[model samples]
Target: MRDCGRTRWWKGAVTIADIKSSIGELYAIEQLARGASAVHRLHPMAKLIATAFYIIAVASYGRYDAGGLMVYAFYPAVMMAVSETPCRFLLRRFLPALPFVLLAGISNVLFDTQTAFFIGPVGVSFGVLSLAVILIKAWLSVTVVLILAATTPMQDLACQLARLRIPAVLVMLVAMTYRYMGILSDEAHAMFTAYTLRAPKQKGIAMAHMGSFTGQLLLRSIGRAERVYAAMKCRGFHGAQRLAPARRAAAADWVFCVCVCLFSVLFRVVNFSYLLGRILV
Candidate 1:
């Protein structure tokens, strides 16, 4: 019975080893749920166009335009709600980029000598207001990009880029890199799990071991890439991955695009405060 127990323990250990070995496949499974919303059904090119226009408008406007930046957020907020992307998930993802936004906003406080108004004893400096504008604009731009990425498959995005006259090589590189990132993430996770299981608790991983671990990962990745390439070649791959082109954009997609563009332009060009002052007069 003692011998049988030992054999069973070893068998369980081997099963974990097998799971770690196939970690890449596991990671790919996780990515399947990333952008599973109905927004994905919209035309990829239309999404790309709207994203590009939004970015340009935000970037081109004056950094002191707080009203403009506030208006810009309305579009993305509406889209997020309508697209069915979980707001909590989007917020979580956006948090990482917040620090950099704050850093840039700090510069506006330090510089820009223009004074805007006074809040009680505290004078409202144009510089500080500019900083707020920058942060808002940056947040809105990032949100749009995130939405585009979440909704569109990487392959479909690449195809859209290709149709937009972007270099084929660049499109291919982006497509392949995006596709393989999940694979590498899975591989790394599996390796770490296996190493943890085998190593003694008292002799935990050290910083010095990372170099060796990274080297091994690179070697394994290279080997896998070679096998994948060979398999593709065997199946008549001709330098580019083949995919069926997406269908034409429907009327609904065109309507969505037009509405977004018109609203964005109006938001940027029209000053509601000035209009309100005129109405009061």
Candidate 2:
């Protein structure tokens, strides 16, 4: 049992390839945003505004009202299909965010036992109900943001943020941080690979070395940032991001944004599923 456990742990350990692959995934999504398809062609501001409203609607639901959350899944499902995004890829990207959500949810399962409903003869409690709500909310929220990213170029999105009257420094911070993720990720990957090559059979960095290992990574990342900034300056990069030339939002863009926001607000107010079930029976 002990040997099997060790093997599983080793197998599950993250590698350089995994880290690089994540960077590749982000690059792929950014490329996807450049496509000429309908969803991609929508104004960045429209998509951004719609996404904000959708998130607000999703987050407004009560913890025990998981059924209403099911209806909200329509947005992500349709967005994935219409946007031509691979569901598996987005889900893989979401794995990191899932754990904390699950951790919070699982506590409700163990602690809150008040009866909430029944699945045929099986009784369900508020705990289980809340867990389902939390999971659905996380999935919906993440998917909405992913869809926004998949459809809107990062610079354009940043531009819309600026147009919305967000502070220039804050927008620059968001843009710069996002711009540096790929670089930092590559640095970390290289350090991890070099560490592994020297001690091939070690499961991971030793606890004793964790501080030094992370400090080295931080130092390299900072140096890389300095070099990047110098290159930017050489190219005449100002403190501002050069947004794409703004164009008038066509009528269709306004219609699309309004419809989506209206529908989201409608769903938040009405339990359409329950009403339909009642009328039919």
Candidate 3:
């Protein structure tokens, strides 16, 4: 019994450590956005426009165009290199969305198994090709968004949205949600730590207690949000809260945006990967 208790205590400690680490990771992108890299210095709108174009180009590729989509990988790679954003951090962020993507992609494998191509000895199905395309699209799409977040501060993003005349409610929600995510995580961490201390013999909050734990967390978050809203009201926060004005795009910003859009167009229209294979052969 004593050994079992000791094991549970160690497991509880590890749970606490995980909570603390997650709280830190919640703000890791914000920290990266504060860097002085050249990518970070470009106007936010330029980056936003470039990202939009790149996403459109990626989505335009057909299900069997996995070879063409490979060229789009350069955008995220170059952005990460130029912005000096850590690959590990972006990869960690990328993983959570992958399961959902894989679940959707796998359905194609099960349903559309007609042969699309063949190797020297084996046949490759259209389903397999589609799955590859889905994975590539998922990676490219998620990585670009992560790069944008890592390089551009959330406040700047909010301001740009407002400048674009996006509805006030959406703009406020985006800003407030981004700002409050860390606070919510911290609250969860604190609650988790307290639970661990109180139930030292428990490996984690038991399934029986999970409902109560989650309900209590939601209640706490709501109460804290009420207080925060009150404070904001006291400071002149109306129904609409616009962030700082975005700076005008400079010549360099224009050049960067044009270059990114052109690159996306060139890769989308011309199958560079196919061309390279032909040249090699």
Candidate 4:
């Protein structure tokens, strides 16, 4: 019984470590992408506009229309390739969100069971087709978000959000959270490392001690937030977070937007599955 308890404790610790490591890696990648020269030339608001439009189109499409969703994949693929972001990086970032989408899709499969059409030897049921549509929508939406984040600096993105009538408080929270998340993550990692160094073989810390540890972390974070607020006040920060002067969109920005809008509309309106059926006959 004691051995089983010890194994479980270590398993929990390992899982925590894996989660932290993944977060740290993602943060590092974002920082690197933000510093890339190409990203500096792109207007942050343009990226924001493209992402917003992509998401809106995806949401407006019918849930059983897999053909529409598949056509939209080209948008992200083209953007990803042109931005020089590695396919591996985007896949790694996007895959973490897929399981939740799949789980939600399972319910759609169980509930909507009307037959839609036949493809090859397979009879496409409404349930399965709907599930596939949901998955594709989720995937494309996530890709758009990732591309936006990769291309735009966090501060710039926050500014764009603020301009777009997102609540000031929510924007501030997002901006501040992104700024301080790295610090908090580092602190958490140090604490975990110290704990492991001292108690590697111990089954687990006592419940009372665990509570105390959490309290300490919260107290430290509160203190840090206070200090940061004081620093901001000293720097002449008003109620609004003033950003650097905004830049006008370049010709490339207009061209990019027009192309994306055109392709997205064309794909959504043309039912590829129906076209394929006609071609086959």
Candidate 5:
């Protein structure tokens, strides 16, 4: 009985720790954006455009074509290394998007049994290839966006969106959402901490309490936002979000954007992986 009690507390600690860590991760990304790397200095609109084109190219690959898809990894890999973003941090952020991707990709393995190729004595099926392609694409897509977010401040990115003629309402909505995410996370973390302290022997809040638990978190966050809104308005804050003075994209920014997009398109059409495989043989 003592052992069981100790185990519950240990698990509860871990759960609370995870919530705290999530709050840290949100701030960490914003902190990294303050760096002065070449990638960081590129005009936000240019980076946004380049990232969009890269994602479109990545999504164009067919489900069964893992060979070509494998070669598209260079964009994220080079971007992270050049931008000096932490690979492990980016990988951790990549995980929350994985479960649904895994659910969909795993089905291919069971449903697709026709053999497409053989590695010596081992046979590989189209389903297996498709699954591999899906997982790789998910990682690539997530990492590329992370690269963009890690290097660009939210205000700058939001301003870029506004400049690009993204609807002002939509831009403001997105900016507010991004700004409030950290606040909400902090509120949730505090609630989680309170629960663990009061119920020290439980591994988590009781399943029956989960709805109320979540509701409480939502209510607290809404209240906090209301207070903050009132405080800001008292200080002569209107609805408009002011951004830094706009700077036009430089010659180098154009060169970098055009080069990356062109390479992405070229890579989409040519299977560099197949070429390398043949050369090795």
Candidate 6:
């Protein structure tokens, strides 16, 4: 019985450590943005517009056009390479969002049963093709967004939003909401540490205590937010907070944006997958 208790405690400690590590990794994108690579050096507005345009183009593909969607992967592949972003790291972030995408894809698999193609003996349904397209679109969209986030600071992105005439209140809310995530995580970590210290023998928090624990966490977070807002007010925050001056787009930035928009249109109109097959045949 004593040995069993010790084993449980050990597992609990390891779980807590993993949680702490994940919390740290949450801010890894911010750290990656600080890199001095060419992609990282691009103006935030340029990257933002390019990313949005790329995603829009990707999402505009037909349900069974998986082959054409393959070409869209080029954007993320090249951006990841240029930005020097690690595939495995972005993949880890992507995995969490996979289940939701899978749920949507799987529904198509169950319903749309018309045959779209056949390979030798096997008939592939339109649903299967649609599923593949969904998966591909999800990968491309998530990867490009991750790449943009990794290369450009959130503060810069928010400032660009302001320049784009997003309402000042909306801009401030978005920026503060992002910053608030760090605060919430920090509070959760501190609370977990304190709980573990207080309940050294317990393997986990008791279910009966969960309500009180969560209530306390909420109270603590609210208090922290209040103090933060007070400090902001003292510092002359006027409804909206601008982290940095909006960067004017350089000639290179305009060139980059134009090229991205042009390539997006090119990829949309030209089915490179079919062209590749023709050449191969």
Predicted model with the maximum lDDT: 3
**lDDT (tens digit, per residue) of candidate 1 on 114-197:** 789888988888989888887778788888987787677677889988888888878888877666766776777677777877
Model 6 Cα lDDT, one tens digit per residue, 25-118: 7688889999999899999999999999999999999998888888888888988999999999999999888999999999888999998989
Error of 4 at 83 (Å): 1.3
Candidate 5 residue-wise lDDT, 117-189, digit = tens? 9999999998998988899888998999999999999889899998888887799888887788777777777
The estimated TM-scores of all candidates read 0.78, 0.88, 0.90, 0.87, 0.88, 0.89
For candidate 6, the per-residue lDDT at 208 reads 62
Q: What is the lDDT of candidate 2?
A: 0.86
Best by TM-score: 3
Q: Which residue pairs collide, candidate 4?
A: none
| Residue 269's lDDT in candidate 5 | 79
Deviation in angstroms for 248 in model 4? 1.3
- Please estimate how well model 4 matches the true structure, expressed as its whole-model Cα lDDT: 0.77
Candidate 6 — worst ten consecutive residues by lDDT sum?
A: 11-20
Candidate 2 lDDT over residue span 171-196, tens digit each: 98888888888888878888888898
**Least well predicted 10-residue stretch by lDDT in candidate 4:** 10-19
Tell me how many clashing residue pairs each candidate has.
0, 0, 0, 0, 0, 0
TM-score of 6: 0.89
lDDT of 4 at 168: 83
